[model samples]
Target chain A: METKDIYREIINEHNLHPSHHGEISNPTYEMDGVNPSCGDKIKLQFKVDDSGIIEDAVFSGSGCAVSQASCDIMLDLVIGKSREESERITEAFMRMIKGEASDEELEILEEAEALADIAHMPARVKCAVLGWRTMEKIFKENRQ
Target chain B: MTNIFKNDFEILHDDKYIYFDNAATTQRPKQVINAVSEFYRTINSNPLRGLYKWSVKSTAAYENARSKVAEFIGAEDSSEIIFTRNSTESINLIAHSWGLSNIKEGDNITVTILEHHSNLLPWQMVSRVTGASLTFIECSSDGEISDEEILNKIPSNTKLVSAAEISNVLGVRLPIEKISKRAHEVGAVMVVDGAQSAPHKPVDVKALGADFFVFSGHKVMAPMGIGVLYGKLSLLESMPPFLLGGEMIESVSRYDAVFAPVPEKFEAGTVNAAGAVGLAAAIDYVENIGFDIISQREEKLCRLMIEGIKTIPFTKYFGSRIPETHSGIVTFNIEGCHPHDVSSILDTENICIRAGQHCAQPLHEHLGIPASARASMYFYNDESEVERFLEALKKVRSWLGYGN
Candidate 1:
């Protein structure tokens, strides 16, 4: 698919059935991500087992369809992964979003690689990263 | 309103250009552009520092611009006008100098709920630094605050009342004269953020009884990185200097330094001389056209937009509908569509409008909305452009699947 096609696809998928579009009933960690420039906000929460593995994650917020849907897709990507592995996934995602990834790094992105085209839209880059950044903060604090 | 000089502005070439984002910035007139260009071509020299001929000419041009701005705003003396980067830095200068010097522990400063973050955040930071308390006078449903509400919030220790003369988001023209009178009665100095007002109408700082007035030049069809800070000479003399550099000092010893006069003391270091000249030319352009006529033209456009937008179903408008009591800003949101999406659709038509919180997030929170789309007008905008905007907005509504 062309870059615009991929972007349109991501926008369409997120708008139709947003992932992690609801709150987590009981979770170990929660954090709010706010993009002050445009007033986009997202709240992410995760449930971790005693062994420090990510059991589940969810998010809720009011923003552009891009941001809300990005959070939804981000939740699906990090679930069922270990805390360390999730952090690595977030770092890899940032590289892809910023368009700084190598060919090998592109392979690592796997399913989330559809969002690499967002790098061209500078204004919407923050929208694509809001969810991943929030998850990174939650895991960073919980790990320590 | 005349077309004799219309061709002078490059942005006016295409009649199809719908520039509704005037509150953000305006297109420079030919005279202002020529003045800036002439500075680099003919008289390119630093002012106040060098005694050479080019320097003298540059200094004279800069000072002449200051005098013109002082007269334009009805300041008592040209010496009272201080130059800064923009309204943000101008307000910051007051917060650091006058605010710190006057406001003490337990001192109260009252502001209105409709202030731009430029006017609100400076006082908030001042309160945090000085231990003084900051209180916001609530705005009405129409975005107007009454004199009674202002009086009720004025405590004995209220040091200042900083307000926006015209709200960038609400398009509501505040009763600054009445508010200033009430503030003075309680011994609080009144500061007006004229960033939105100065561009739309004639501003008389003396007539408004404001102790300090600040506005950015870019919003007035001048260049960016230049702004004016008008203060009473007494107040400017009493406050500490905002920045320390070469030009703002009278003499510097090993240990202590004597500062220059009021305006010079506030204007530290090399100023934006070219930008100041361009600003003066902008003022000259507006004056030649007459503010009353300019304001009248804008009011007509505002009414046209209001009527046009109201006809669209599910279009909820915010702010004052009264023409006389409003600026040129029109903020609204469709029921189902987000402001960003509306902005994207409008961008397709080349009809520029601002979307999102407009740097007034707390006000958005107060209004119980996440964000809004604002269509701010200027004198250059006309009824036909507003019609085009309304047409585009209708298309945006349907495309967003709003209003079945």
Candidate 2:
């Protein structure tokens, strides 16, 4: 896709009804994330069953459109997956976001392929990964 | 294009480079460079330690530079000026030496929300080390703090009032004279961080009524790694040396050691002779141009830039819009675009500017913004450069799909 198309898609997704937005009811786990360089913040929450599978995930916060959309997109990827499977997905997603994925791995991130254009713009990379980092922190803390 | 500083420095670009990142550091004049080269080529010897001819000449040159610095800032005695690595080290010396000795439990050290991290973090660490508490005086929406507000914040436990004369991020010109007087009324010593003010305008420590004044030489058009810390003679005498080594000692024995007096005691190691000479040359260059002319020129440039930025529909300026309240900086954010993105786009044009927190994160938090783009002017920036910057900013806004 063209750079403008990718940017337009991100901007549209940001302004339209974003997925995984709003608070989760009676969340079992929650974590706060902040981008210190810019003061952007997000609070992510999740519900996990006794089998360590994520039943649901939601987030609420204020930030740049890219950050909001990135989080919304990330929430759609991890719901109903086991905690171990979610970690593997997050690692694969990060590699794709950083433009370090193999061709076969690139096929896995279908709708998320638009984020590949963000790698050329260094400043927006943080915006592209804001939600993913927050989710990573949550799972890392859950294990501990 | 109109020449700001007589084209003394080459532009190497069109319509003059918008050299607005003055708070980070300044471009050196030809005179400062020549002075440094002359020092290295001719009198290359350490000061005060040797009695040879070259050593005596070098020592005299260094002392003369010290005297020039003292006179430039209206210091009562040149012996009260101590050279350090930069403003960070100068403030650190004060925090360690004076704070370690004077502050006790329950004492309060008041600073403001507009301070650079260099001024704020040192006091924060000092307050943590000692049992003292750190209090911050609130700033107005426009980034100005009233003298009355500062006075009101000085409780009975307040021991010091540390403030910046001009904020690096906001460009707010604080009323140092009034604030210093109020601090003195409360029996608290006032310290002024002159890193931003000293480069743009005249600085008279005595007139400001500050107990201590600190500034970096590089910010004032000299080379890096050299700065000045000026304190009152009595205050200097009371505080112990921060670092101990060869040059700062008066006499040493196996059992006992005597320290040198005031400023010499603080300057514990070999000094930056070339850097000091370059600073003195910078002072001479500024004096020759006349500070009143420089101040007027920079003020006019700032006004022009502010007016230009106001025309951009999506741009929201962060600090005081009143001309008198702001100095040479214009910080603002373009709607719908992050500051880092704005900075990257501007960089493609070789238009240097500072983005992100500008080392005043708390101020950004208070302003309810994540980051801001700052364009700070100097005496050398011309009006044509301001025009070019505005045109480029409009282009950037359109490119980001924010401009109609």
State which candidate has the highest TM-score: 1
Residue pairs of candidate 2 with colliding backbone atoms: none
Which regions of candidate 2 fall more than 4 Å away from where they truly are? A1-20, A48-56, A64-129, B1-6, B11-17, B51-54, B395-398, B401-403
Task: Give the alpha carbon lDDT tens digit for every residue of A1-144 in model 2.
Answer: 544555567656553467778896899899888877766688999999999888999888766666777787777777888888777767877898788988766665656666777787677788778888888888887783
In order, what DockQ does each candidate have? 0.34, 0.29
Task: Tell me the docking grade of candidate 2.
Answer: acceptable
Clashes (backbone N, CA, C under 3 Å), per candidate, total 1, 0
lDDT tens per residue, model 1, B1-404? 34443566788767656788988998898899999999989998999879899999999999999999999999989999998989999999999999999999989998888888999999999999999999888888689788778778877689999989988889888888988888898899999999998987888898888999999999999999999999999999999998998889999999999999888998888899999999999999888878888889888888888888889888978988775555788899987667876776677677889989998888888888889999988777777788889988887655543335
* lDDT tens digits, residue span B1-404, model 2: 45647455554234535677887998888888889999989998999899999999899898899999999999989998998888889999999988889987789998888888899998998798887999888888788787668768877678888999999988888888887887888788899999998887888998999899999999988889889999999999999889988789999999877999977899888899999999999999889888888779878988888888888888878778775456778898888777765776677676888878888888887877878899988778888788878888887655455426
**Candidate 2: Cα lDDT at B126:** 79
